[model samples]
Target: MNGAESLVETLVDNGVDICFANPGTSEMHFLAALENPRMRSVLCLFEGVATGAADGWYRMKDKPASTLLHLGPGLANGLANIHNAKRASSGMVNIIGEHSTSHLKYDPPLTSDIEGLARPLSHWVRRADSSDTIAWDTVQAVEQASQHPGKIATLILPGDTSWREVSAQVELPKRVAAQPKVPKAPDAARIAHIARVLQSGEPTLIILANKATRGLALERAGKIAAATGARLGSQFFTARIERGAGRVPIERIPYAVGQATEFLKGFKHIITVETREPVAFFSYPDKPSLLKAEGTLVHTLVEADEDSALAFEILLDELGAAHAKPVLQQRVEVVVPQGALNPLSIAHALSAAIPENCIVVDESLTTGRESMGHTMGAKPHDLINNLGGSIGYATPVATGAALACPDRRVFCMVGDGSAMYTIQSLWTQARENLNVTTIIFANNSYAILKAEYANMGAGVPGARALSMIDIDRPSIDWQAMAKSMGVPSVSVDTAEAFHKAMADSVRTPGPVLIQVRL
Candidate 1:
């Protein structure tokens, strides 16, 4: 068998069944090997879409999905989304093909420092120098990606290495075979210390992230909160937060620095689970870098790489709160919103329409702030936010989420400006006939930038600056845009109309779009 075949087989053996690809000539051998039915290959129009889709797959499946890219330029094209995936702690295995080793001295047009391009975004990076080692390398990459909290692994394959014949595949060593699959439990001493702090009569807050924000882990955290009267909250941008009615609701810390500072004022001790001390996304002039109040003591019960769920379980037992009934959000009455389209009305409309078992991919930026709080009581659903602060992730991510959980509907929300970046996702969604309803907040401008301009302490945007932010001179017709991509769509100018469009799309099969003009 050829190296490409060996690599594919190894990936299959490791249980990575999907490959999101945007292959070029250098990757033909890998492409040819894709005919093996063990692995399903998906074609993405853009490399960013492939990487973003892989991110979404991992968030749903808790496993790595492989991405096939052409070369350095192809890797570069996908880096933005890879950055997003890395920040989100989503597992991914990227196979970035390179030119033949012999062709490197000639400085070919496609040749570049692929490692340099991948290092910034990848947790593990390796190159398959020979056909004999390619399969071993593939398995290593898969293992790295499957670790708790997940990771990004990039394996660079030269064309010659992929096409070369291999007598036999490389096997993992005995030591590698014995490596533990389970994450190590948190330190007993540390958990005890944090428990002591929680027992103090001072006001405290428990901040959750990663696995601690969802599932039984979150329930245990809620029990701890109930027992100690400690507040529970999460960072503004967690990867995947389990929210909605019936789930224990953890308040998301506000994004605005001043607002977050005020929100954190009452807390004396802040214990973080699977997250770092809260910090501002950007360093604004004169603003403190940390979000917690200056005197608040921040501590860690679980580090990011540790098993937060297990840690929380231990803590629950230690605090004698194991059987404590946790507080849950009550289902709110969904009153169909009426009147003009604004953030609150849009929020109310969505609170009324979002279905149970939905996967919501949010890249709505400034426009989504109002809607996020309302959705907590809508239904039991998964909410994915942009942890890397990257735009264009929602559409592509929604497409993959739908693919991962075919029985559940996927909802993608993005500002019109961000949607334009990976809009090709709609075409793939239509072609696959996936159940995804993409909502475009058609504000006709880069609304996030307008808010950032003020936050950055810029005096105010002049006509030229406003011109750069505005897309209104020739506003995009989203309905036409989506239809051109084979997605049925509607343009709504008011809350009532948007409510009907959202509700109707949920019942329809396959992909659809709703443009909510602001």
Candidate 2:
């Protein structure tokens, strides 16, 4: 068997059966090996599509899917979404192609360091030294990716190694289970310290993220808050948060450092579970990086890899506060709003119209943050975000999420600017007939960037700078574009119109786009 064949067999043996791919010359052999009926290969028009789809698949399936990229440039094209996947804690195996070892000595143009590019975002990176080692390397990659909380694993395969013949006698490595992260028990001294701080009559806040954002961890934290009057909050961005109707709701820390500092200033104690104290996403010229108030004490209740639920349970036991009922939000029936077109009205309409058993792919940036919180009480649904802070991921991720969970409807929310980044995702959605409702907030500009410019302390710009922020010189016709890509679509300008269109699309089934002109 050749190296490519052995690699495929090894991956299938390890339970990685799906591959999202946009291949080039170096990957031709691996592509051919995909003919094996055990492995399914999905062709994507762009590398970003491939990576985003893998991300969506992991979100639903909780299993790693593989992506086959060309050379360094192709991998670079997919890096943004891969970064997103990593942030989401979505596991994925990236099989990147490289020049043959023999050709590498001459330092060809495509010979950029794949390992260097991948290290920042990936938890595990490897390059197969020869055809004989491909099987073992592939197995390790799968193992790393399948770790708890998920991880990104990149395995580089050179062309010569892929096509080279390997001995059939070479045995595939045994697959090992990923190690589980065990939560450290709080010591008696630490527990007493926290207890004293809580009883000191000073304001305190408990911040949650990762496992603490959902299920028992959140419930326990709520109980602790109720018992001690501590404020409960989360980081501005999270991997996955189990929120919405009937679930415990925790407030998110404001994004701006000034606002976060102001919000947290009164607290004398800041306890963190599975996360750290609030910090600015970016460093500003005159702002402090940490958002905690001056003289506030920071305490670590649980580490990121630890089991937050268990830690909270222990804390509650030590405090003699178990059996305290956590506050839960009552689920509300959907009520469609009637008003002019605006961000608030759009959120209300969405809360009323999002169907039951649906998945929300949110990339609406500034517009959808409040909207998402409003919809939490409306229905039980899954919410996916661009965890990597990258734009242009929602559309393709929605497509993959739909494919992963065919029974659930997918409602993708994206801005006009971000949608154009990977609009090709619509074609794939249409071809698959996946039930997806795409809402494009057509403000016709890079709205998020505008906010960033101000946050970064940039002065109000002249016409030329403003022009770079604007995209309306030739406004895109989303309805026409959706139709051209074989997906039915409509344009709406009022809340009433958007509500009607969204309701109709959900009821009828199949893929449809609703362009909200703002």
Best by TM-score: 1
TM-scores for every predicted model = 0.97, 0.91
Candidate 1 per-residue lDDT over residues 31-62, each given as its tens digit = 99999998988889999999999999989888
lDDT of each: 0.89, 0.84
Per-residue error for 1 in candidate 1, Å, reads 1.3
Clashes of 2: 0
Clashing pairs in 2: none
Per-candidate clashes come to: 0, 0
